[model samples]
Every structure is written in structure tokens, then in C-alpha cells.
Target: MHFDTRLFIFIIINIINVRPNFGQYSDDQSYLSSIEFNRGGSLTNLIFSSPHGGFLGANLTLKKLGKSLNNETLTTILWQLPVAGCYNDSLKQCVYTLKDCLQSNNKILSYHPDARCVIDRSSTLSMYLLTKAIAQSFVSHYHPYTILNKLTRQYVDPAEDLPRGTFLLESAIRAYIDYHRLIAIAKEAIRSPSRGLFIEFVFHRNSQTIQLGYGFDPLYPSTMGKPSESTMHELISRSGPSVIIGNNSLGYFLRLNGFEYVIPMEQSQQQRQIRYRLSTYSTRMHADQRFNAILFSYPIERLRKHSIDQEAKRIAKAIEQFIQTNNIKILSSFASSLLSVNRIMRLCVLFLSQSFTMLYISH
Candidate 1:
């Protein structure tokens, strides 16, 4: 099948409708003026993110929440749970570290006080930008600070005290709302005759491996296109063992990338079933078995582990290789093609429009 212009148009319109409103305010003298979500090109399912690569604006938000490196106030601390990191409190903060938990001093033991690590996910934003610029493809960034700010409400009111389970409940609600927004986009894209694969990008501070996530047991409907096991295995093989490594790329990427992973409450067998049950709401929907959500998580300390530019190039190349190797089809020709001149005109129009969208969206 040839390129499906209709499908492409549908994708573009959806993105434009949801495009973050960063215009008019562009001349404003704040980094907040430039911050946007759902930024990237359209017509592809490939998505990338630097969830933790948002330190600049994040610090601003922290300061607004009364965080100060000098005096001890109700500081907003970026901390990782003991289960989330491979580092001890004694170790210097490394690149692979992701401070997922957001807590306030008012909340007793809401998060580990000593495990705070203020480093951004290093060069993840730059890495993602490089891939998008070169590939001319779509990517997304989940501003960790924005998400966490909404979760902890520290920026809104640093002194606002929350009960033990209140913060967690609010976080889960906010997460689901954002996640469903993405899922809606995917569902619309999938409705196109040329269904594309939905990809999520992430960073893992403790490892320098790319983890892949796709497929599901027969119980659920797939949300993205279904990529076979052989496709995943082959893509992994081509990426080389050194390029692919991580414990939970799918889970982490989903949480950060706006596709929060969900499991059926009835099937959960954990000890804290009530707590888990409270967290498991309709918004925390898992990727159905049909939708193929492939996750790519790079090492956090990638700048020090290796050259940042090289790492970006390697990952970008691997992604293209995976798409082509899997023979993933995303478009189809319509009945009775137009004349050569007409086709050329259509191509030119599409490119011009796409370029314009990318120009504003990528900022």
C-alpha cells in the first residue's frame, strides 16, 4: 500500500487541536513562556520524552514552593523511592537517577528525606530534541515538574498539609487524566486505516539499556497496533545487547510518558490490596492487548557513561532500524490515484503544513 494522506491529515488535525498553546506568549521573558506539552511532528506513533530533563523550570517551581538550598524551609525535594533507585544515600547523585516521588515537609515520611537528588535526567531533553530534528518525527515530553507539581500541590501551596493517602490519591487522579489524553490520541490515530505503533521514551539512571514493552495476554483489547514477538526480539537483537537494558522501561515510561500502566483490580494479589485498589481507577487504564506500546529507556548518566551526542545518534538509528525491520505499515493508498502534478502539489502542501507545525511545536 502507498501513503495514506487522509490518515496523515487526521493525525495532523488531532495534534493541532491538542497542541499546547505556546503562541502570543512566546515573547514573554520567562522559560515558562517556552514550556509546552505534546510537542512534536505528526503522522507517526514514535514518541520520546525526557521526563526528568526538566530541571530549569522545575527549580523555578521549587523556589515558588519555598525550596531553598541555603536555609531549611518546607523545601520541595526531588527524591526517588528506595525501590526506584540502585544508589544508597551515601552515593553521589548519578545520571541514571530519577526522583519520582514528590513530597512536602508537612507530610510525614511522604518521601525519603535523605534520598533527595536534584539532578535533571541529565541530557534527555537534548537527546530527544536531536532525534526529532534529525528524524523529522513526532516526540512528546512529560514535564516531570509540571506533573509532580500537580501531584504534590507544593507549588500551589507548599504549606498545604495532606493526609498520608491524600497525596497518593491526588497523584493517581492527575496521572490518569493526563494518561487518558494520550490514549485518546492513540485511539484516534489507530482508527485510521494505517494504524501506527505508539512508542514511549524514558530514562533509567541505574542502567544503560533500552527496554522494550509490547503485547499482552489474550484477555484485553489492544489500543495500539499489535507487533509480534519476533519483531520485538529482532529489534532488540539489532539494537545489540549493550544498547538494550533496564528493569521496567514499560512501567516507568508509561507513568512518565502519560500512559499510566494499569492492571485489573480483581487480578491484583498484593498484600496491600486496598491501597492498590484505591490507586487502581478507570483512569489508570493499561495498554490494551491490541495496541503495541514499545518503550525505550536510556541510561541517565549517559553523558558521563558515554558521549551524549553519540548516544542520541545510536538510539535514533536503532529506532529507525526497528521500524523498518518490523515492516510496520502505517499508511495506504486510496482508490484511483490523481495525476502526477496533483500528487506533487499534495506532497508540497503536506510538507509545508507539517514543517509549520513542527516549527512551533518543537520549541
Candidate 2:
């Protein structure tokens, strides 16, 4: 039986807050500028649009993709648009020249960027133009603090040279969600929508480190920091003692699967040792350190055999103690958000047990 008490609370609270129908905002979205390629060179056949990866191009791409998906003719123009160098006063062609080149390749084109780690929405394919449309919609609906952003920042690389700090995957996810939603809408428009056309869209990550320069500086952060993404050949995957780890879905899956598996976190495709986190809804819980590496060290397996709720209460107590002693947010609301069903309940119980954190809860 799925005693997902903790899961229930999140389902009731968090999921409802997120607007999956991102495409609804299509009419309002706008863009800042465009990319420019060399005037002389023929545009590359393949296209590689990075919804999230480009550090410099991300903001620009969002505006462009947003405008394109909303208009049928504009979308077609962008698909065929050529470009030279990105962002400058210099003369050139279309900005999406690189993206078109990647798309022209004989084999299926793929994209993955490391710096933008959050829940990858575009990770999944969609029915048609619908996917891209909804992706634009989602980006339009949400915005971060200062009103400049559409999505909230989830991960912050402490080592990044840039001064900005925000969730990397938030905007990407909004667009992805919008894309799929558009696909759904387009199909619904059909006199008889096709079932086979429904494509599964799973959030994922991709890496093309070799394409980018390998030289690294201690002050700069790159995906290569993880030991697994070192070589391109090592990208292959095999079922073994090693298990994927990152956010709550993993913690729950690992708890369900087996304990002996290696606690290695890697993206599905870039199956190297890259520690990426996405849709870690549990991080919203009260315990500050509730969903970090401590998850690997926790004694969850032994706790599972007993009444799941009882054991969850115990784990919550231990986590609560750790939080209090550390003088962290005794009421860290989003940290342990993805904990198991019983775990959330147990956390609330533990919260009541703490005299100091207790005063805030009741008020």
C-alpha cells in the first residue's frame, strides 16, 4: 500500500499552486533582441536551440521563442532563419544559425546544458507545434522577484563567477510545460484527436561539454566538476549497484528499490556522475537540511519495515533535532517538502514537539 501521507500533503498544497497550462499566456509574451551569424557563411543544416543552457543567449532566446510559437508564420520563419554571431551591433544573418545547423544533422538532434539545472520540462517531446507553444505560454505567465523573471531560481552554484543567483530550471520548465500544453490543445482542436500522437514528456538533462572549451578555472563552475561527465565515452548506462540520486523522486524510488545500490546521481541521458536536482518538491518542507546529501546517509531502509508512519515520525524527530541544534530555520518550509507521506506527518508531529518552532506554527 502506498502510505504516501507526505506525498498527499504536497499533492494537496504544492501541485495545485503550479500552473501547468503555460500556453494560456501566449498573446502577452515578448522578446528583447535576436542573434546574428556571419553574412558570408551558408547556414548550418542542423539546428540546436538551447531553451536553457546558453548563459548569454538564454534571456534572448526566451523572447524569440515566445514570439515565434505564438505566430504560425513567425515560427516557420524562425525554423528556417539563419544567423552569424550572437548579440552585437555587427552585421550578420539570423541568430539561430547554430540551432539550425544541429537540426540539419542526419541523426536526431539533441540538447543538454549543465549550468541550467532545475526540472527540465522540455526533457519530454510533445505532439507538435503545441509543445513549443505551451512552452512559450508558461514562460509568459510566471516571473521572479524584481519582476524581471518568469520562474523562480531553484539551484545556485556557489562557485559561479556571476553575481546572479536564482533557480536555473524554472523558466525552462515553464516553457516546456507550455509546449506540451500547446500540443494538447492542438490535438484537441482536431475533429478526432489521435491517441498515438500523445508523446511522453519527461523532465531530463543533457550535456555537450566537449563542444564547449574544457579549460577550467578554479573561480569558474562547469558541469565537469562531477567525476562522471569527464569523458564522452562514459555517457553509456548499465544497470548495476549504481543508482541515480538527486531530488525527492529518487529518494522515494531508492527507498522503494533497494539499499545496496550505489547512491550516484546522474541525468538519464548524460548518465555520467553529474549531481543534478529537478522538481525536488520536498525541499519546501520545514527542515532546512531535510533534502540534501543527508538523504543518502539516512537510515530509511530499516525505518521502512516498521509502520511507515511510526518510522517517519522518528526520522522527522531526528531531522528536526539536527535543524534545531544547527540554529537553522526551525520552520524551513520548503526543504523537506518531498519527504515520504508518513514523513511529512511525522515532521508536523516533531514540529509540535519542539517548544520554540511550535510557537510559530500555531500562530
> What total of clashing residue pairs does each candidate reach?
13, 57
Candidate 2 lDDT score relative to the true structure:
0.25
Name the runs in model 2 displaced over 4 angstroms.
1-65, 68-306, 329-363
Report how far off residue 212 is in candidate 1 (Å): 3.1
Give the Cα-based TM-score of candidate 1 against the true structure.
0.38
Per-candidate local distance difference test: 0.34, 0.25
Name the top TM-score candidate. 1
What global local distance difference test value does model 1 have?
Answer: 0.34
RMSD of each candidate? 15.9, 22.1
Worst 10 residues of 2 by lDDT: 38-47
- What tens-digit string does per-residue lDDT give for candidate 2 at 166-213? 212333333443333333343222211111111111122232110111
| Tens digit per residue, CA lDDT, model 1, 51-131 | 223221122111133432334444333232322222344555422211323334544323432334333322335434533
